[model samples]
Each structure stands twice: as C-alpha cells, then as structure tokens.
Target: MADKSLNKTELVAKIAASTGQSQATVDAVLGGLFDALAESVGSGTKVSIPGWLSVERTSRAARTGRNPQTGATIQIPAGHSVKVSAGSKLKAAAK
Candidate 1:
C-alpha cells in the first residue's frame, strides 16, 4: 500500500471538489477556522466539535528532570500544552 497522508493543499482541493467551492475559497475558510481555533486555545479556552474532536490547553507543574547526555539533574519548569482528543465520529471513521 502507498502512503496516503493528506496535506493542507490536497485537503483543500478535496473539500472544494466535494462542496462545489473554489479551492481558494475552501483554503481561506480552512485558514480562518485554524486561526479561530488557535486564538481560542491560546486564550486557555477549550474547543469541541461534537462527535468530531476536542482541543484544550493543559498545564504542567514544575518538577525535577535529568539530562540524558550528562546524566545530570535539572529543573523542569511548569508549562502549558495543547491536548487534542478524537471524538466518537473520528474514531469510527478510522476503522
């Protein structure tokens, strides 16, 4: 089997063809959606598309860590991360 990963451009083209929209218009809409998602997540807001996916910001506390190369101990600082979870619909689609 060949690798069939879909990139942004291909995704845009596919959506455009399916929706009867111009590729440029589809790409712009996708871009806007991504921008909105980023803005919400950056502001610590959770975003959920029911039966599709969910994205949220997560917090990590500071802790101790190790330097693999030197085997030395180091301090790990607290930080935030984005978590994405696939919903039922997405999981079902993969099967």
Candidate 2:
C-alpha cells in the first residue's frame, strides 16, 4: 500500500505550481482533458499519449456466472469496458 495518495486537488495544485498557472486554470484544463478523453473512449476510439498512457474501450462477451449467495448459475450480459495502460514513461517513473 502507498503511504500517501495524491487526489485531484493536490494534483491540480502541483501542476499549477510547476507550470506557473493558477489553480483554477489548471482545474479547467484537467476537466477538459477528462471530458475529451471520455468522449473519445466512449466512442470506441483508442487514446494514446506516446510515452505516458493509453486508454481504450473493450468488449466483454456474455457468459455464465455463479450467484455466490445462492450457489446458482446465472447468465451475464455482454458489456463494454475501459482499459487503461501505462506507457513507457509512466512505467519508468515507478522504477
């Protein structure tokens, strides 16, 4: 487990400080970035940042599942899901 986690506010503050921008501006930029990302990914388009991250939509097939409480079998419907991959730069930062 990590000792400390940075939330959205802290992240916006850090970015604002590093870029010499106001927190409000940084927050708006972040909001726009997320909105764009969601729009693109929701439309089945893959989003990639060369060395930082990639996100895409994936399809999950319908299948049988078990109900744990009743120990009964059930059918699970097909669904779409999002997959996020950390790119080389982000992976390197962890090392």
Identify the candidate with maximal lDDT: 2
TM-score quality measure for candidate 2:
0.97
What tens-digit string does per-residue lDDT give for candidate 2 at 1-95? 77999999999999999999999999999999999999999999999999999999999999999999998999999999999999999999989
Residue range 1-95, candidate 1, lDDT tens digits: 53778899999999999999999999899999999999999999999999999999999999999999999999999999999999999989988
- Please list the residue runs of candidate 1 whose C-alpha ends up more than 4 Å from where it truly belongs after superposition: none
TM-score of each: 0.95, 0.97
- What C-alpha lDDT do the candidate models reach, one value each? 0.96, 0.98
Error of 2 at 48 (Å): 0.3
Clashes of 2: 0
